[model samples]
Target: MAKRSIYARELVNLMAGHWVARAVYAAARLGVADLLEAGPQHVEVLAKKANAHEGALYRLLRALASVGVFTETEPNTFSMTPKAELLCSDHPNSLRPLVLLWNELEYSAWDDIVHSIKTGECAFEYRTGSPFFDVLEKDMESARIFREAMAGASRLIPLAISEVYDFSGCNTIVDVGGSHGNLVSTILSTHPDLKGVIFDLPNVVESVKNKMGDEASRCEFAGGDFFESVPGGGDLYILSRIIHDWDDEHSIKILKNCRNAMGSDGKLLLVEIIIDTNNESSFGNWLDLHMLVMQGGSERTEAEYRRLLDAAGFELTRIIPTGQWQNIIEAVPASI
Candidate 1:
């Protein structure tokens, strides 16, 4: 009975887990890890550099150190740990942008999760009185941060996709909605003979032109809406994290567009989280809630994916699990 009581208490603590998330967000926002990049610093020194209250900074550092984000060398001095290093923007696999994105704006949207549950609408739009992307479009800083957050969160998944998936024997691989062209760049680097196309909106393709650099030489930047049409003649089309943002009807439209664009022997790859059955502990389950709150989309099961692909005039061939958060759902045109 005592152990049962302890377990129940632990569950309650987990329910309030966002407190620590907000604390870490505050640390990332203030660039605490970056400040410690030079060396260990006293809390007062960090507070001065970050323009925060010294005592409050010390308290924050103490709590974070308890969680292994940093190490307290002395009464007020703190040093970065490997975990804290991830919050530094200079780190190669830094999650700084994602942490920053989870700050006040995300919190405000999440606070209205109840409203989303009640109305089957976006909690963000309900709270902010506008769509999340519309607000992002108006605010350049917010838009930049959101993009960086997405890229940062995609860190290992692109490399994992490039490495695990066989891209051989394909003339052209079209990355639909390939923002920043990271995945295609990784793929092109591995498959030398494969020409790649980054297909997205005009502004999206333009924004990442300079970012593509040498990859731009071997890749074509085609600007258009995937729902309307995609560039033709590509044997393989990669739709990474694109379909989950929409409802079933809209998802079908985008998939149908891919089907229309793909030739008889062409393939369509969807990279998304595949929710498992009766698994309350799966990350995808919680992410499904996040999706429900942020938009009306939800993480899908393998069967659900098959139904969607069939409805979009495609046949689901296989589902490959990647080393990252996503699973690759491969399909071909039904006629094939």
Candidate 2:
């Protein structure tokens, strides 16, 4: 019976995850969390403001309440929980963009996971008629949302990197494909002696410039294609969650670009999830499937990273584990 109960619990948990995602989507779409930012409100009042049915809204909130997303002080009144507060749009680490993107793009593509299993091709392009980046390029609104989502996801990475890695000896650090310069800002803020460069496409740099502010003076923004070239001469080139976005060929191109741009004494720091073959339950493995469905990339093992770095003319130096499940792979230019 214990075994049966465990199976039942797992089944319930899976269903609960779906329920939570749908609830989050509804809250995001209706701006419920944002509306409740001031205080709690009656269900009818919230329903009326959101143009939703009163009884349905109550039921929805009740479902979310059971999961601890919201709390019910009275029968039909709802208030935000610490968990639900993260959905608020104004929050610096808001999950709204993530919810929107996952539901809009990843969720639908995920429905065709069998397609990936059978053919080993991205379900996104198979379903959407274009690659993810290409689709984002054509749709400005989606592109902005995607960029914002990336920025939000990156909010913690810089701090994690700063805490885990030693940047004492480094002077100039280049953040390759650094979106919004958040990671660069975090690094520079931590290491007062380190001046940094945020390198990405022109549009990405433009979008982030205003946010950079005074740090903009210390940090240089270089707009160019990573495939074509990277700004040279930095002692450290940081690629945070960058390599997992491409296949080996393209990943090699970007790494080689960094390698070429590096000074003889330079190091390349790749901040990413390193998959362990021995681990059964790993987020990196799940993300590997996500990459297959969305971006056609794959999370790699440390050995794979070593091989890629070697091919790109870099010597794999050290792998430092961060506070999170991420690891920073430090590599240096191969001896001539």
Candidate 3:
């Protein structure tokens, strides 16, 4: 017997990462975090309420406990760790929806990861026989979770972005493809004078229309396809986390529509993960693979974004880093 080298240990950790993700998804799907939110509970209690086998649940928790997601309080009792608390549905920055959404997306797609890489086709579409958005449209429950997931990921950015970028010049902010209106709500709340128009698919819009909170009075909701038209006459049109969900052809169509909707003074703000050429460890670089597997999109570099924007009749202004999960790429309609 011999001690394994650090490289081998690191590789092992990397290989076992998916096991952790799937296990977390199981806990989320079972509403385990919500059940444990009050306090510690016996495995039997969790299993009964979760409708899962008691013995299997215990084994799952024990393995998750080893990873600090749960703490074994006693022989068979457990409580959520700080990390696990994030999976609670009511947590302000809850990752529960993301966990659920990712699980739904990856359940089949990840199994076809090889096909995605070799064929340059979305693994999800390969297995499901429909595009991701179409599937979301058909399944109302999954659509709701997807909206929550996007807003949960985006809600933190508005706070960080407002501190760095001035929105005072912009009289109206049109949130294109805004899922839950969380981003626009935050922006309106922060800058009270600015009006917001949240646009998404009709079903999506209807679901999130009431989610705008105190700012609802100043906001309007519209439902339509961005490829056809965006809500016109907006000073700042935001395509937050939208471009990364489609290939260049579709993305350009959406951008061109936005460009057509804007006047010369209008600015287009794209919030997304910008992949870096230098770092293999970059989060965006890894997510680029996820876009390929799940959405048939790829995260882009600044240069790539510039090219894409230019093709759709816009000029890249400056990219602002919000010290969070994404950066804001601001562009204006290009001169004729």
Candidate 4:
């Protein structure tokens, strides 16, 4: 066999990943994984169920099968792979929403990446004439998908948090900017003795309340704005994946709210991805760019977190790794 050139092969593989992502996105949109859940199905049946063209659907399935997302069990028939299982909408760890969400949010924004890089402005905003979050607000469909996508992606984080952190001695946990109370619910479920407050916009508060059900017995839904103020009298405050959505000024403002809401000896725990200084292939590295393009925010290094927390009237205590994508950042009021 003729030896292939390693350099060209690697570069083409990199380019092929772009095609694979698009193929995966199409599969997700067409509900392919869910359709294949029972057993293997021929393209003719899948296309009809999915309201897609049979020939095109077959080609898409073939491409995905080559990459292990699905398997071409026999000619014209396909079955799900472990990778494809993540696309099943009913799966607890489903990434289908994320794929759909990327199609709505990131895919087009990524097309005009040059503009964001050139002007230091959000590509989503520049292209759509609205900020990323604003788009979520105006477009009801976008908002729902965004919520589901984030909730699905962070589903395990709550379990990780409950397991890794010691909740002893803390009576109340305030999940600032927490949506649907999943994290708060997990903590409250773990530490039955502790009470929880779900703080967010009025609409989100209602959603959280609706979702909490029996858990509401030990939880309070505080419907308000974090930019102005937060609910007080909490033993500990949790700001999970919140600070990274804003620039330093807004981040500090939210941190200060937590600081003000804190009692003496109160601690702040922020769930975020801690970025390292050195260059490496990391999710944080990819997210840093996503933050840059969608919002003017960036993932922070330890030094950056320390500085941000210090300016917000707290001292960075330590960072706890959950052996997952996110780490727990602990801080305390400086005076204490």
Candidate 5:
């Protein structure tokens, strides 16, 4: 009975998990970690700096400290923990943008999860009367934050991909829907001989100009919609986190357009979370729900990927697992 009661308590905690997530989000939004970057400070000091109520700020920090996000070295004085450091915007691996992005915008979408479940539609769109991308486009600050969040999250993905995939054989690589050319720059950095292109919407390409630093000489930028057409002249075409934003029909449309542009020997690579079918709890499963609720997209299983590839006249050649719930799915033109 005691064990069962403990399990029941665990269930209740799990059910109320949003409280913890929101707390973390709140800390990130408040820039509490940023304020503590210099050293330990009293909650009153932090509250003044942040323009927040002292008592409420004190409670928030105390609660967060209990969760290992911050440390209360002395009464009412809080300092950053390693986890909290990651919330500092200047930190190399800072997740501040992601945290802020989620808390500020995506947080509200979760409120409409019930609507999504009922209609199999986008909760974000349902709530705001505009699609997620449209909203991001209209809000410059949000778009910048969203881009920073994506870039911060992608810091390791390019290295993981470069290590796993052999880009030496390919002379040119094109990243479809590659925002700001971060991934492309990473690849170009590793392979000196490989030239690359960052292809996306016109505005996105324009904003990313010369942002690739030293790799700018080797990397080019192209602007267009993937649904209509993609640039050619690359031996390897990479679609990282592009396909999953769409349904099967739209995904197929994009893939087919890529196929039209790809040469006979060119290979297509999709970077995504290849969901597990064993029903074991995983981050990908939760992310799949995020997709459903937020964008009307989905994270797919390997079998589903195979079908999608086959439908687009491509053959699924391999799946390379990257550590962070992502996989590099390699495909080739079926006829080739």
Candidate 6:
């Protein structure tokens, strides 16, 4: 039987997301999941292969095993569980990038969560002494991880958005700040008639083009800062999880740029989590905090979205809930 003290201690232990982060990071850094793809091995063998200390690596594996990340076949041998396989870098739905990004950039920023709570300022800027995007632009490795994380997110979002929104009417779709063209690829794959353009910074565009290959041939790549201008002439403009990266003033400028580029008949879709006003349970609430701690942007409620749209000379037409946390907010150019 479980002891009372054991129950209390386990409850406290369950709340530490850091353990999961560290374990995942270790698996990523050591390529443990990749090694296990060939199958399981003894702790001594695995540790030597990964260049880790046997006893310490065993302890880490034991901790992860309890959470079902890996399975202990016997006393000192281990095998990959289903959960562990997701960490494999070559897995189509791999979470390696997500784990790495959180551990590297997000984790460091979170060290100053107290400052963010107190001053409502981004801990990222406070810690790094530069804006998040500026730092990303300067650092190549971090930028690659960021792009991969964004692409992973895009894969999930495409499944959600395709189900709720009809892209049948769209001839040309522009994915603003689209990283690696994942969203556009998903869209084009589903709707063959649609053509696309990926708009992002020049460095990002270069990276995306290299990754996209054949898809790059079909979709145009335009390198320009969204703060300055966006490529014109797409009937449907999609800003997927883009606005939340900036303050209200900057977000409005991006929306206004889309407004100017869009024709009267064109549609503007902002794919994002609409924060609930009633302070209820929400994924966006947690994400809002992360944005604050990491980037200084806050998620917005539907009313806040409406206000931003109005300021940008667009009328909020409809809010289509995707059942998932994200919603498709459709807007149109307002009459001057």
Which candidate, 3 or 6, would have the higher TM-score against the true structure? 3
- Winner on lDDT between 3 and 6 is 3
Q: Summarize candidate 1's per-residue lDDT along 115-156 as a digit string, tens digits.
A: 888888888878888876567657767767777878888978
- 245, model 4: CA deviation in Å? 1.0
Query: Which prediction has the highest TM-score against the true structure?
Result: 5
Residue-level error in angstroms, candidate 2, position 63? 1.8
Which lDDT tens digits does candidate 6 get at residues 97-172? 8888988777889989999899988999999899898888889899999988877655678777766788877899
lDDT at 31, model 3: 91
The C-alpha TM-scores of every prediction are: 0.95, 0.93, 0.93, 0.95, 0.96, 0.90
Candidate 3 lDDT, 133-212, residue by residue in tens = 88888989889888888877666887777677789788999999988988888888889899999999989999998766
lDDT of 5 by residue, 1-336 (tens): 699999999999999888888889888888889999999999989999988999988888888888899999998999999999999989877899988887788888999899988888989889899988778767878877888888887788988998888876899999999985888898888889999989987767877885678999988899988888999898899999988888798899999998999888889999999888999989888888888877889999999999999999999999888776689999999974
**lDDT, candidate 2, 1-336, per-residue tens:** 699999999999977787788887887888888878889999999999999999998888898888887889887999989988988999998888888888886689888789988998888988988888778767778878888888776678789898888887888999999887888898888778889999987877877777885667789989989999999979999998889988899899999999889888899999989999898888899889999888778899999999999999999999998877778999999997
lDDT of each: 0.86, 0.87, 0.89, 0.88, 0.88, 0.87
What ranges in model 6 sit over 4 Å off? 1-11, 277-282
The candidate, 2 or 4, that scores higher on lDDT is 4
What TM-score would candidate 2 get against the native? 0.93
lDDT of 1: 0.86
Error in Å for residue 55 of model 1: 1.2
Residue 76 accuracy (lDDT) in model 4: 97
